[model samples]
Target chain A: TQLLEQSPQFLSIQEGENLTVYCNSSSVFSSLQWYRQEPGEGPVLLVTVVTGGEVKKLKRLTFQFGDARKDSSLHITAAQPGDTGLYLCAGYSGYSTLTFGKGTMLLVSP
Target chain B: DTAVSQTPKYLVTQMGNDKSIKCEQNLGHDTMYWYKQDSKKFLKIMFSYNNKELIINETVPNRFSPKSPDKAHLNLHINSLELGDSAVYFCASSLGTGLGQPQHFGDGTRLSIL
Candidate 1:
């Protein structure tokens, strides 16, 4: 069984602050995905990184895939109230199934 | 239009009762999945269907059954619900079944068992 471990289960910061969340796994994954979920709602796909050492940026959020494909990180620059939510990292093996991390709860106070 | 949709956004019932949650995707995808999120915000994959066939079945209990009528729809039927079953259920779909494709998710269904 593949397991993805995420660091800093909970985070709280003031507006305009910067924070980074990490997802690590012992097993290598074929791809990794980042999702953000608001209260009472399902997660929305923020980004997917397939290749090793890949990086993608969406507005104030930047996602990076580790060179070994066994880890990933999500960095939010100048976080705002809108950026506060549950951040999840899902790692997919060579197959179709995805192993999800415990997820990080971010709170950006204005 | 909603790419993926789940019915009965909220379900409240007593323990030992039976209920079902329906999901549909109009993204022309052939694979769909069911995920469960616990109170601590831990998400886990329950089941997955590809091309109307069961592809992945996690360690979920037999009380929870998943059925796919077609490529575009997957429904979850839970029998003899337990208090532990109270959680948010999400439905998602991808172009096929792989890592590169991004799976789109529907607004989850919140199930509460008393």
Candidate 2:
């Protein structure tokens, strides 16, 4: 079974603060995805990194895949209240199934 | 319009009772999945169906059954639910059974067992 571990399970910061979350795995993945889920709602896709060492940026959020395709990181710059949610990292292992991380809960207060 | 939709966003039932959660995707995707999020918010894959065929079935208990009547619909039925079965059930769908395609999710069904 493949497992993905995410660090800093919970984070709370004031507005305009920056935060970074890490996802690590022992097995290689064909693709990695980052999702943000608000309270009472399902997760929404933020970005997908397919190639090793790939980096994708969306506004204030930046996602990077490890060179070995076994790790990923999400960096948020100057986060706002709207950015508060549960951040999940899912790794695709060349199959239709996905292994999701434990998730990082972010609380951004204005 | 909602791309993926799940019925009974909130379900409260007694233990030992049977219940079902319905999911529908209008994105014309060929694959659909059911995930369970525990109280601690740990999400795990329960089942995956591709074009009305069972593809992935994790170590989920037999009491939890998944039925895909067609490409656009996947439903989950639980028999003799227990307290441990209380969790948020999310339904998602992707274009195909391959990597690189992002899966879209529904609002999720929060089940509370008494």
Best by TM-score: 2
**lDDT per model vs. reference:** 0.93, 0.95
- Cα lDDT of model 1 by residue, B25-87, tens digit: 999999999999999989889999999999899989999999999999999999999999999
The parts of candidate 2 lying over 4 Å away from their true place are none
Instruction: List the TM-score for candidate 2's chain B.
Output: 0.98
Query: Candidate 2 lDDT, tens digit per residue, A10-60?
Result: 999999999999999999999999999999999999999999999999999
What local lDDT score does residue B18 receive in model 1, on the 0 to 100 scale? Answer: 96
Best by lDDT: 2
Candidate 1 per-residue lDDT, tens place, A1-110, comes to 89999989999999999999999999999999999999978888899999999999999999999999999999999999999899999988856898889999999999
Residue pairs with clashing backbones, model 2: none
Q: Which stretches of candidate 1 lie over 4 Å from their true place?
A: none
